[model samples]
Target: MKLVSVETPEKSVCKMTFSASAEELETASNAVYERTRASYTIKGFKKGEADRAQIEADRGEHTFWYDAINDLMDKDVPALYDAALAEHGFVPVDAPVYDLVSVKKDEGFVATATVALQPELNLTKTTGFTTECVTPEVTDKEIDSVLERRRNAAAELVPHKGPAVKGNIVHIDYEGLLEGKPFQGGTAQNQTLQLGSGRMIPGFEEGILGHKAGEEFDIFVTFPARYHAKDLAGKPVIFKIKLIDVCVRQIPALNSDFAKKVANVDTLDELRAQVKQQLHDGKHASALNRAKDQILTQLADAAEGDLPSTLVESTYQLQMQQIQQQLQMQRLSLDRYLSQIHETRESFTAKVRTSAEKTARVRMALLQIAQQENLVPTEEEIDKQLAERAERTKKTLEEVKAQANVHAMRRNEGIRKAADWVIEHSTIEDK
Candidate 1:
């Protein structure tokens, strides 16, 4: 093969013209014939016995020509394209559309490709984009709430011989009636209810208050307007209640011994301190992460570049497909989902396009930053990433490599490193 010329008709488009030698094209044609000759049925010849010339004569003069060109397309064209781009120092962001100029048995073929190049960004304000971050303080009430949960977790259930009370677990047989008729999902026997837990309709649990085991009575309540079941919402109902049994919860006392047993701390004060510090640290880390996201978003928003239309369109299509797939998983139609989210098709499409454009900008900006700061991951890092992916998917490393898009993987990791770099180089101030 010979490379004739390389031209960039636009900043985002590359055009390359190349030709294949006659020997190469003939070899490819013969290879294609050899691979497909078994399927050819020639007159007075057994299957797979016909030579290329006989098949060609019976078929057409250009019978093997198209397949051979396509075969070269699959075999050598990509390497040539990459080599040409490398020599000229250009990286394509999207697939190329090719045009076949001419082809013949003697002269071989000449072709031209129009490729989309990745947009290089001139990134500004890559650091010190201030964002609001609140320093978290854990109140004593919050700490006490945590400790109270621990106490309840260690509580024991003990049988009660007499009347039920708030915080007592009760077993009962009952039927609920609306308009003097039993409704669907309104009857059960020996159903358990923890009084004051608010698990049942309001006034239903409190109705069991002071009722001893084996007592039978009727309690009335109305469902809340916002209830999930529309038929029952905001409707008054009568429940025939029978108390079968009751049990009181015996919660642990909050003390030094309780702290030592539950939290492995020497004293209650020490346990409180530990819980408070852990909560503050977790909240602080979350705040900082959100601030970092804001900073990078601003950086990408400030980045200057005209995104390639091909990349933007492809990304937009992919995102739309993904959204449609998600809607399918939820057993919904796209129109219905939009209605539920209060968006019309036009607005939704605009939103999707905006998001896709922003995504392209973010990627371009981060990659540029990565090039400038040397934050690109090494081969070992990529291998580790692949190994982690293999572990997560329960596949062998080789299988992961075979199925994974390695170039995308490298780009993603580099973008991630660049994002972290942007965050690390900036300071998030307290609001």
Candidate 2:
């Protein structure tokens, strides 16, 4: 094998060309042919008989083998050329590099090879940008609002023999049937539903307004077109419901006793102070996230390099794999998920492409920042982060490390470090 030429540009990419001998070409061709055959299932071949059949089929099938082998050779040669370039310290296209050259073949059918080198950045002089951050102040009214919610959560329900009222709990026995056939998940016995809570289907909740306890009624309602149950979707059903009882929730006034019940606070004043602090912290975090997003948007706009198309494609594949896994966890298929979201794969892919591009730009920007600022994480820091992740995920360190590798967690960490650097140095004008 020999090297022909190499070219490296300022945009962190390398290109290389090389040649291979007839023997090496034949070897790669055979390997590719074998792999393809192993995955192929010919008719009338018994279980586990495909491999033997494939080999036998190849011996007498010169035409089949030749076509398959030639196709493999076409693909394997370029891939092998890439491998050879890397082996000789030359970077291939899509690989970051800062140098290039050409070389002549020594004594092979493969004529020549080109080589490229990975790019390196000088960490000292790049201008680092920053943003301003401020902690938010929580008001007295906000604290009181939180206290009121806590009181409502701790309220007690008192039995009443009157008509169902707003904010009251109503117990009912109901069965919904479509065309006189009960559907799955459509029947309930003695279910407690909060009146005016809007938790149930839109028309279902409002239909019970005038019904008193022990009253039986047939309420005809149409299932929303987007309802989760495929069988009931866009169908009209009649629910036979008997109202059993109505009970009102009695909430205690916001006082020292109520405050103590809700938390460890000894007085309402202390509870208000704690609630205010909590709100202040929440608002501050929200503000920081918004500021970080703005800074990242600007950085992406200012970025000056071509992103690797291969990397974006790989990221998309990973995203798809995650979606597949989540669907599996929920006992669903990709088709079901798409139906639920009212999306097709083509539309979903188009939508995700924009997000993928933004993600790729953010990643590239962070990597550039890391190189420019000498922000490489130390071995100790990596280990500590890995350990913390393992503890938080309740997995073994090795498992966490492996999963992190699969999920590009290290790359995400690098991006986070870059974000921290940007946030620490930039100026912000709050609106």
Candidate 3:
């Protein structure tokens, strides 16, 4: 075996010159012939009968035999080389091997292979990274806010014979038309509008203020430019309206009974305790995320080396795809989302690029740490992970294996292990 070329980190192309025995060559030739016979269905040949004429014709067709022989060699030669390498306690890198030979009677086929292996990562030590996270105390004020929302949610609406109040629910029939033509979704029948609720358009709820039941009127209004309806946007329209009834919100007293009704807590103190615990949990989660962000920022700053552009670009594309999917889930398109936010695709792309770059850097850093720590998953561990994944995804092991590439899965596991290690070793300051 002679080295043809050497690629970095366990990739190489090599040429091997060897003589094959007559029996060995005969075995290979017979294998190729059998494969060809099985693959092609020649008309005029009896079933399972060897057609010498057809075989000869096929051999004469250089392109046909060239592909056939090359494929045969491609599939069989690697195993032979691997076997040879095993004898020397070395494994052949997983790549295709080709044979180059002169058409001579006794000359053995000379083969060349381009091989690849897992890259060797030599990671440098990373340090000087620190993160400050503010875990806010869940105060009485925050708990009170949650309690107020709960109270409002359970508030009762009572018929108000007097003037409409701020929290009153007013029943009305309204028709909005643009250019004297009613647009789709621009009209509602006997819809309940809550005054000062901010549930309707900016000018809609206030337009019917101080109106009694059974009153009829038409109010001129202009649709905001950011209105969902494209046709009526930024256009002046008249809302033909009729007031049906008015009811005021009767807010429950902030007492034990109200707490029991809204939160299933027997007392207001219990409700406050529950709300405070929830607020504390939410605050802790937010603080942890902030800490992770700070850690990642520091790690990215400390990280040194050229990140593969291909990897970063692929990551960016995946992030963009996820964002688009989320927008789709909300029944909006990326364009519509940008329009709603008053942003362009370029601005979104820039924002996504920043996030993607940070994620890629952290991922690469974790991988390097895993390598340095020799934190590779054992074969048994990998199998266990695969089994769990199959169970979780409701797939058979074989089906999961077919769909989820095992090698990639292992690599991801390594990165996860590295991240776990980083979090375990890091110093966390609670505020």
Q: Which candidate leads in lDDT?
A: 1
- Give a tens-digit lDDT track for model 3, residues 1-431: 22223233322223344334434454555556676665565566665464545765654533243443455465565456556555544322223334465433254344454433222233444544556678788888888888788777887878788766676788888888878988788799889877998887767777778777778988787888988878777888888998888887887899998878877889989989988888888988899888866766666666765554445565688899999899889999999999999999899899898888777777777766776788867778888877898999999988877676555566678878887677666666777
| Backbone clashes in model 1, listed as residue pairs | none
Question: Which stretches in model 2 have alpha-carbon errors above 4 Å?
Answer: 1-10, 15-132, 176-186, 196-239, 286-431
Please report how far candidate 1 places residue 289 from its true position, in Å: 1.0
The whole-model C-alpha lDDT of candidate 1 against the native structure comes to 0.86
Query: Over the full model, what C-alpha lDDT does candidate 2 score relative to the true structure?
Result: 0.67
Error of 3 at 24 (Å): 28
Report the Cα lDDT for residue 101, model 3: 59
The backbone clash count of each candidate, in order, is: 0, 15, 0
Ranking by lDDT: 1, 3, 2
Per-residue CA lDDT of model 1 for 304-358, tens digit only, reads 8787776777778889999999999999999999999999999999999988888
TM-score of 1: 0.53
Alpha carbon lDDT of residue 190, candidate 1? 81
Q: Hey, what RMSD does candidate 3 come out at?
A: 12.6
Query: Best candidate per TM-score, number?
Result: 1
Better of 2 and 3 by lDDT: 3
The 10-residue segment with the lowest total lDDT in model 2? 96-105
Clashing pairs in 3: none
